[model samples]
Target: MSDRPDDTPAPRDADELNEAVSDLGETDTDRLEAVRGRNESLEERLPGDEQLPRTHGSPEKG
Candidate 1:
């Protein structure tokens, strides 16, 4: 048996997936909120909280 429990929710079928989509609401604000949340999560996963400066047209690194 797997160590983790199967308590996680799953889309049993297409109908369930459709229902979830409707429940989630396909709005622009919702999409922006989701993207912001994802960006926050990715930033948190970065090496440090420092924001590096942009170095466009710079020399290639070795």
Candidate 2:
């Protein structure tokens, strides 16, 4: 079975399914935050809206 329902086939074995689930657990937070940051940045870039802080990038130098 697959966590996702895209065109791709679902995992056909217990080991493959376990591997996929473990991979999700490992990267869930980082991936979610990245999505959130992109969303915020996009909103901030809209015309007539206040700019939001960027989610990524090196800190500015003094």
lDDT of 2: 0.68
Which has the greatest TM-score?
A: 1
lDDT of each: 0.68, 0.68
User: What is the C-alpha lDDT profile of model 1 across 1-62, one tens digit per residue?
Assistant: 86667996653798875565564448857866876888899988886524655456686678
Report, for all candidates in order, the number of backbone clashes: 0, 0
Cα displacement (angstroms), candidate 2, residue 61, comes to 49
Runs of candidate 1 with Cα error greater than 4 angstroms are: 1-25, 49-62
- What TM-score, to 2 decimals, does candidate 2 have? 0.36
TM-score of each: 0.38, 0.36
Segments in model 2 whose C-alpha atoms lie over 4 Å from true places: 1-26, 49-62
Candidate 2 lDDT, tens digit per residue, 1-62? 75677987754798776565564345868666766888899987786623656557786678
**What 10-residue stretch in candidate 2 is worst by lDDT?**
17-26
